[model samples]
Target: MTANTGFLERTFKLSERKTDPKTEFLAGLTTFMTMSYILAVNPNMLAEAGMDRGGVFTGTILASIIAMLIMGFFANLPFALSAGMGLNAFFTYTVVLTMGHPWSYALTAVFLEGIIFIILSFFKVREKIFFAIPTSLKNAVSVGIGLFITLIGLTSSGLIVANDATFLSLGELTSRTSVVAIFSLILMAILTAKNVKGALLYGIIAGTVLALILGVTSLPQGTVFSLPPSISEVAFKLHWDNIFTLDMFSVMFTFLFVDLFDTVGTLTGVATKANLIEEDGNLPGVGRALLADAIGTVSGALLGTSTVTTFVESASGVAEGGRTGLTALSCAFFFFISLFLFPLFSIIPAQATSAALIMVGLFMITPITNIDLEDFTESVPAFLTMVTMPFAYSIAEGISVGMITYVVMKLCTGKHKEVSPIMYVLAIIFAIRYLRPILPF
Candidate 1:
């Protein structure tokens, strides 16, 4: 065997997936194409809360590289990690601006959250929680996240429009962008039906080209290569003053709650989609994934960015037949290379990624068949999970609702013996989240 091939086989067991280095590379590129928008969007958002745009930009990319590598090497899974979307908004707007906390204090809170996560992960508390979840709900989480991803893709591609009456309506298909996205979806469906290897990746590239040609999206104008911005302005700038104060307690708890549920939901959803969950519903190497996420969050705070978490966009790579960590490793390399080639990332229109995400979302739906519909106790909660994910616009929210409903159904049906202790704990936590707004404490 050749040296590179031998190394890949030994490290990632690429043979298990029947995927070669080239396929892994393409899958990685496909994942990056879909997620690279964060490289721009995160900085702009954080800047509104008093962060340096350039520093946040640099920190975002660097943290992604580190986290992705750790996930690749430690978890041996095809997941990618980066600064999360909603959490960053909370970090900037709610924590820093609204709460009147300094940006440094926000970073310190994130740092504390990360340390807490590390401790939890090391003791396998996070992994145990995964195991404690009922199999029916685990399957529901997977299907729920799938619907959530589809919602994101459709809205992002302008195939769906916001409305006052129904909350959502059909977009103008006559619009060039929506039309192009429709065509892209059909093309990807055809490729997948034809059993094309890396069909998702191929579709994304083709869709981007088609969008560019049809004037559905404008090409980015900038230098193709440039030096990365410096992170020194914000790096290692956390302030721990009053960290133990009551005010900081709420800030830290908020960070911990959101991060924990988000990570759990993402991991469970992605593992189910990729078929990485054990027959017993346990996710192998999950501790590593959790550790990678916690380390990423900590490093992001030190390097000057918001909390980092596993990207749901990694499902796009899995849909492209990426069954090993080589995909994540390859993606990490692209994140580093992107420091110079970032302008190219902008040229990939949202329609292309939306197409891929929508298709991957479709692939993740098969797990729903595993739910026992005859059992009302299982079916109702499962249905709640599937619908609430998209309607609520949050995977974690869907999971919370599902678990809460699951526990309620069990107790009401006198199936309390079926409910694990962790389920009760989660229900209480979800209760606290709901009560947060009204609690005078």
Candidate 2:
């Protein structure tokens, strides 16, 4: 083979390719379905926070397509990338609502944050952050996020989480929206259980079909959704008005830190679980993955959305037959195509995507096995992290509780000697993070 052909063969793994036409197509579809719900919900959530509707519309398409493409082309990990749950919620409620910052300022924050990440990534400074985390805590955080994402699905789907007094609300099951999502969940469960190829994809297709047949589609008909319109609207905010306020700066770092570490921790855990690391416990593409993530955030900001990063749902594809970069690329292709098919995305009921999320959530249990059950110190903190994230509806809270408990557990068990000095610094930092919003400065 010529050098060019040989290089392509190796990079794409063409020579050793195990082309499962049925499986690849399913993997592509599953990636698309994983994000279908977000296409609408993200915009809806942001729109409620005073974000431009056109910005919302354009940002989702561009960020989704750009993020997926970068993840496919550069990171070469089976995971798909996008603006994640915690960061988006943080952008909407925390920065905009609680902190009272404008969306334009938020985008400026995102752009600056991305630049910081890129600079840190190039020098490998981010590696120090990873080293600071104990393996035990890392596993716990991974499983905790799994719980966090699951809780999001449960609450959002109106599954009626139990309240303190009456104990249970049956959610909005009878509502047309909830009904479609529920049915999608059922369909996805059956297909996945039966080991059907692309079960998640099929479930999404079925759900989309059901939604369309029932007239659930919300995209205006006969309108072409292309690049320029989206470019005009997305993460495009530049607020000269609040450009130098203390509150604005405060929101910027908050968005930056939360988004930065959350992405790192989530990626580390998923990568570890997937055996994406080598025997030395090193991740070669980890820097590249982080770069892709940081760029995704910058792109989202440019397009007029909140912060963007890698979504853990890509783990679902990994759990399937997505053992190569090929899978990531396939996912990217579909995400870009969905731009033109925006109407289809808006129509697919949340329950259908819930099906994928629920199944993927279940798959997130791999990290539980990594917990050291024999060590109560490790076990207690790990369990608390997993439990609190979902129940409290806050990933930050879950992590806070975990950090405090881990520190206490280590000291009490006479294992404080085992903790790293850097871990001590982070423990102090996480404590401060927890206190910032509540305490009077």
Candidate 3:
């Protein structure tokens, strides 16, 4: 295969290239519902950053479908890739809204970061980076993301409140949002436990209907779901001027490292769960998967969104026993169909998606058993990461605190010799990112 060969030839199919069409369709439906939440939100995030709202939305649909196809046909990773959730929030609310950085600058940062990802992946440095991460921390990160995602669902669904008077807030049991979320949560659990086909899809469907009854749709023809003309509007505007900022390196560095580990961690966690990895402890065709993911990030940025990566919802697909590339190909096709069904997504309110997000959050917790809490050295950092993520309302913050604690604890315990050299390097990088002041200029 040539260096520029498409995603397929890069990853080989070791098993038979056949699967049941019905099973694949069900898997595809499951993947689609899991990702439906992002269709509207990702575009909305990039638009706030001054990007073409239409282009980003179009990009969200295009890149997601394309990426999922690559994952399906090439990598067979049983995962869907798209503009990541936290990355969008970080780009919009944190970098743009909070830091007052120009949206263009943040995007420029994403572009540079994507290039870096591709370079690291092509050169095959991902394994070195992964080696630096302690297996204990890997377990912690997988579980932490689960906890953090749960919080996102709670806040998105309005089940939880933010009180200015009260320092902390919890679920408001009397709230209708709470009732819906709890109800959906129960439904999802029952379906999952019973091994129902497309249980998550059914759960999300129930949630959306619930949202309609609660007036969350806010659309005229509640049952008729179709894309509005504006859904295809190309919206990205290149701010080449923002590319010259001195802060580009700082911002890009953050994104590059964050995405690198995040992708690897997600792959490891999911691969472990699915038993898709070989006896060598490597997921078969993982290199190709990483390349596909890096390509997705690069393409996503060019399309006008954040760096794309494999979603955790791939866990749901895997849990459903989707072993072949057909499941992913089916998912890709449905995502493309969604471009014309924007009205459908637009009608499914955040609260309903929130129920599904909460389900994904629960689904992600399957890796908790991977951690060995018997050792205080490993347990402390892992515990800190798992607890801090939701409390801090940020995954990065949780990871940063975990890295510092992991390094500092190892050093103090005189077991610093046991820590990987890459971890030490990561500790410094994370330290610099943490110490840097958030300048609004």
| Candidate 3 lDDT tens digits, 194-290 | 9787776777778778767876555545555555334233435335675566566666776776777667767765666566655444566677678
In candidate 1, which residue ranges exceed 4 Å CA deviation?
435-441
RMSD of each: 1.8, 3.6, 5.1
Worst 10 residues of 3 by lDDT: 5-14
Question: Which wins on TM-score, candidate 1 or candidate 3?
Answer: 1
Deviation from native of the Cα of residue 383 in model 1, angstroms: 1.4
Clash-forming residue pairs, model 3? 52-235, 52-236, 55-235
Model 2 residue 147 lDDT score: 74
Residue by residue across 307-351, what tens digits does model 1's lDDT show? Answer: 999898888888787778888988999899988877777677787
Q: What ranking emerges by TM-score with the best candidate at the front?
A: 1, 2, 3
Report the lDDT tens digits of candidate 2 across residue range 241-300.
755778767777877777766776677656665666555445657777788888888888
Q: Report the lDDT of model 2 for residue 284.
A: 56
Off by over 4 Å in 3: 1-24, 93-105, 165-167, 171-174, 218-237, 242-244, 277-282, 322-325, 435-441
| TM-score of candidate 2 to 2 decimals | 0.85
True-structure RMSD for candidate 1: 1.8
